[model samples]
Target: MKRLIFFLVLLPSLIFSQTNFEKGEKLFRDGKYEQAQPILENYLKENPSNLKAIEYLGDIAGHDKSWDKAIGYYRKLKQMKPSEANYYYKYGGSLGMKAKEVNKFRALGMIGEVKESFEKAITLNPKHIEAHWALVMLYLQIPSIIGGSESKALKHSNELYKLSPVDGYLSKGQIEEYFKRYSSAEVQYKKAIAAGSTKKGSQMLTNLYINKMNQPEKAAKIKI
Candidate 1:
């Protein structure tokens, strides 16, 4: 009778906690993050070890551009679940965004860890397309002096190609364009269009023809 009484006393609180989490999760899924945050935060306070709650909070912080908060949460997630490829990816991405807002020296200092995190994700999941794409952009955007290399970018782009041919061609085209090799970019972009007929590929090709190649007619001729 005492045990039954104890469970009954606990039941209402448990049910309330569950309802709060469900409500918050529903809001999150519905894209109502502002409405979800406080409820999730309250639920997390009561159920501190909830992984999904932690991830949702991290994602909310990331969406709000609260890099420091996002980094803290994602780092915690990484520590708690080291095998999760996505936590490392999110951690690296947060660091990358934060890097962009700081001094050049500080940003440069962060490069190694950022690269390592993304690489770790790839290591954990070889066929991880987003990680491969992140590396591709990372290699292309950084200065050559700070470990950026066209060869390195191309290497990941090739990996993307093997996993996703359309992405492979599009990324390769982006690299060529970055180097002002418009003609090469054109070829790659055309290949991307041929592979997937993606609007992004079409737009890129059209932009290249119009803006870089100074051929408005060619741009207009291509259908989106």
Candidate 2:
């Protein structure tokens, strides 16, 4: 009789907590972060160890560009679930964005941690496409003196190509475009369009023809 009374007393609170989480998660999935944030925060207070709530809160913070808050949440998640690849990826991404806003020297000091986090995510999940893309961009953007290398970028791009040919072509095109190799970029973009027939690929190729190559006629001829 005592145990039954205890269970009855706990059931209502548990149901209420679950209901709040469901409602918040629904809003989150619908991209209504503003509406979801407070509810999720409240739910998290009731269930501090709830991974989904923590992740949602972290994602909301990231969307708001509150990098420090996002980093704190993701760091806690990493501590809670060390083997989870996505937590490491999110942590690295938030850290990288924060690094960009700081002084160059401070940012430089953070580069290794950002690199290692993404690399760890990749190591944990080889088929993780986003991690590969992140590494490609990281290697491309940093100076050569600080471990940046076109060859390293291309290596990740090549890896992307193995996993996703369209992305591979697009990333390679982006690298060429970054280096002002308009013709090479054009070739890669064309390949991307052929591989995926995606609007993004079409737009990139059209933009290249118009902006870089100064060929408005070719840009106009591009078929979506």
Candidate 3:
């Protein structure tokens, strides 16, 4: 009888330890991050080779903005599965967020890390629009002195344009307007409008011509 009781007690613990992933997943889905973390962490401690567990823990840490923990989890996952593009990209994003909390020099390193991750993502899956756009935005935000390249930014922008012409045209127009290329901006904006942009397109066109191009009279003549 004592043996039976001992077996019963140990069975639950054994099951819990082995199938902790299901429990952790349920907790995460229910938004119980605090409860989920420990269970996931304990499971990962023993099964350091479990990519799925590592990925989930990284996701949880990221959602909570626990940058250090998230980076640690993602790095482990990346090391385990070096060929997985998404893993590296996710690690890069975590690093980028953590960088924002640090000095500029450190933040610059984070940006470089982000570029490498996104580049690898693109290499692994050229059709990844999110990674492509992220690279474009990152390059644009960096200053020339800090290794920013306008040409690289434009290249991504053009690729994005080819992938989604309407969105690409509008975004390119916005970039042109930023650089004071009013004529080019106007043409692209108009193209977006004709290509079935939302009402926001009309507003953008009106503002660009009136504010940037200094032609309110012409902007007023444009019909929505």
- The candidate 1 region of ten consecutive residues with least summed lDDT is 191-200
Candidate 1 global TM-score: 0.92
The C-alpha local distance difference test score for the whole of candidate 2 amounts to: 0.95
Tell me the TM-score of model 3.
0.69
Clashes of 1: 0
- Flag regions of model 3 displaced more than 4 Å: 1-15, 165-224
Model 2 has how many clashing residue pairs?
0
| Backbone atom clashes (below 3 Å) for every candidate | 0, 0, 0
lDDT of 3 at 28: 83
Q: How would you encode candidate 1's per-residue C-alpha lDDT over 1-224 as one tens digit per residue?
A: 99999999999999999999999999999999999999999999999889899999999999999999999999999999999999899999999999999999999999999999999999999888989989999999999998999999999999999999999999999999989999999999999999985698999999999889999999988889
Please, what is the whole-model Cα lDDT of each candidate in the order they appear?
Answer: 0.94, 0.95, 0.82
**lDDT for position 90 in model 2:** 97
lDDT of 3 by residue, 1-224 (tens): 99999999899877877788889878988989889989988898877788988888889999999999999988888888888878877887888789878999888777877788888878887767777777776777777876677687788888878888776777777677767888998888888888888565678889997788788898887777
Q: Considering lDDT, which of the candidate structures 1 and 3 is the better prediction for this target?
A: 1
Task: State the local distance difference test value for candidate 1.
Answer: 0.94
Of the two candidates 1 and 2, the one with more favorable TM-score, higher being better, is 2
Best-fitting candidate, scored by TM-score: 2
